[model samples]
Target: MTFSIIGRCQESGQLGIAISSSSIAVGARCPWVRAGVGAVATQNVTLPALGPQILDLLETKQFDPQSALDHALGANDYSEYRQVTVIDTNGRTAFFSGKEALGIYTAVAGEQCVAAGNMLAGTHVIEAMVPAFQNTQGSLADRLLAAMHAAMTAGGEAGPVHSAALKIAGDPIWPIVDLRVDWADDDPIGQLDSLWQAYRPQMQDYVTRALNPTAAPSYGVPGNE
Candidate 1:
């Protein structure tokens, strides 16, 4: 079982997803985002392909978030067994929870964001996340992490979550930030937060290195002396 949020930042046009689950390597299968297209979090008997499939519907077919989610998941006979959330570049949102969703599933949609979960401790997990994202001030990444933390505070899934992920699709062809704790017996969300902090300062440098290596930040190697 899993919980996730798909969000679109109005200020910078960034699309992102923050997710956690009892399953290992949840990042490899659940969260998906394309810089100029959208984001999808497919979990609860996740069909990993569905993540990109939803994004493809949004990109290639020019479908809005709702239309893309409808077209993509509706076609799958197993759709009812899954839970998903979507947010497109335009800040539109969509979500679905299958009839067969695990224990105590919940979904909450807010301005520019949508949160969903199955096998959750309570609906409050999703409820806590939406407002956390809406109320937090800072970059999209900041709000996303805040939402994930709040979900845990409100009591996450019915069981312990072993993995967590944060992914953001900014102006580049690649994800600007994609951090994950594939498996952590301890606090995966907190570990993910630490990774984000460590990576934040280098975010722009990585982009610059890709587009203009000469202008990228110093590596801080011994040669720098």
Candidate 2:
């Protein structure tokens, strides 16, 4: 019912996740990133806690992606129903897809990234995502969105994906980008793309507003008038 990619930008040292699913509010459950730590995507019969837990391991415990994933998966009684992907700050990646993960499951790992899907149209859904992310020339967020677009073009989930999310973490304590289409009967990916386009230019403005409101640009809203 879901497919996702977790990746790091080698040049900028940012981490992010792009995900979509037949389920609603997939953003709230599947993707997690810690600034200067790592990124995680927990899907299939998702254990949302696993996402943060893996990041905590990578950050606080100094565990590599594989070690963090192994520690987390080992403790779970229902590991077979879960699918997870992890990438550490150093771009080391690891992934696991349990035998019980529902229909057409696969996980593909590439330099600085991992893509995973379950209940997909085919393995190509994830296969297409990796190269798209690796080859796309842009910011980490742009590459992530491109990967999602590629996945959708490759046939996407076996059923309609109602929710989609893009989350990226840079140097800030909060995410540099966090966009979501909680539910849409059609094209959540397109909606997310539009959101990204609107956000890109203003992203630095948002950070500036947080750190120095007086120097920040105008709110540009009706209420400001």
Candidate 3:
């Protein structure tokens, strides 16, 4: 009942993922990423545990994207009901879409990116995202956001979006930008874009402070000065 996209941008050495689903609070169900590890998007009978489970495998330092995905899928009996996409720090890509997954859903991968979605109008939704990421230039988060926009432009999921989110992390524990619209009007994708633009400055400002705390004093008063 939904169409969504998940991807990572390699240019910034940062990882970002965006998702939009027809179901209410889609962001809460899909999309996950970590710096230096990997990203996972599990949807269509979504299993939230896969988020951390995949991360844990990556943390072991023994598994790559393909191995990690295989192991994880193998452990679950309902694996056929879920769809997943993984992109590791080295840019290795992997994806699994269950046989029972909604029609029109598809996944595609490349050297620096992986795109996947279910309940879409057709395969083009995912096809447009890969090239868009390849040709786009900017921060990982920016490119990821663009990919989601492209998916929507290509006739998005077969249903309306109720929730959307974008997540990216690097060195820092917190995501560079983690924004989710749980429920919205008819145009959740556009709403997510507007919200991301509004929050980008603040998020960037936060990262600037995190990476260089000393620089904070220059942007504001010292000791209430």
- Best-performing candidate as measured by lDDT: 2
Using lDDT as the measure, name the better of candidate 1 and candidate 3: 1
Candidate number with the higher lDDT (1 or 2): 2
Model 1 CA deviation exceeding 4 Å by range: 221-225
Best-to-worst ranking by TM-score? 2, 1, 3
Can you give the TM-score per candidate against the true fold?
0.96, 0.97, 0.89
lDDT of each: 0.91, 0.93, 0.78
Cα lDDT tens digits for candidate 1, 28-144: 999999999999999998888788888888887568888888888877879899888988888888898989999999899999999999999999999999999999999998999
Q: Can you give the lDDT of residue 204 in candidate 3? A: 64
Native-structure RMSD, model 2: 1.4
Candidate 3, TM-score vs. the true structure? 0.89
lDDT of 3 by residue, 47-96 (tens): 88887788789878899988999998888779988998887777777889
Residue-level error in angstroms, candidate 1, position 148:
1.0
How far does residue 143 in candidate 3 sit from its true spot (Å)? 1.0
Question: On TM-score, who's better, 1 or 2?
Answer: 2
Clashes of 1: 0
Pairs of residues at least 3 apart in sequence or in different chains that clash in candidate 1: none
Q: Which parts of model 3 have CA positions greater than 4 angstroms off?
A: 208-225
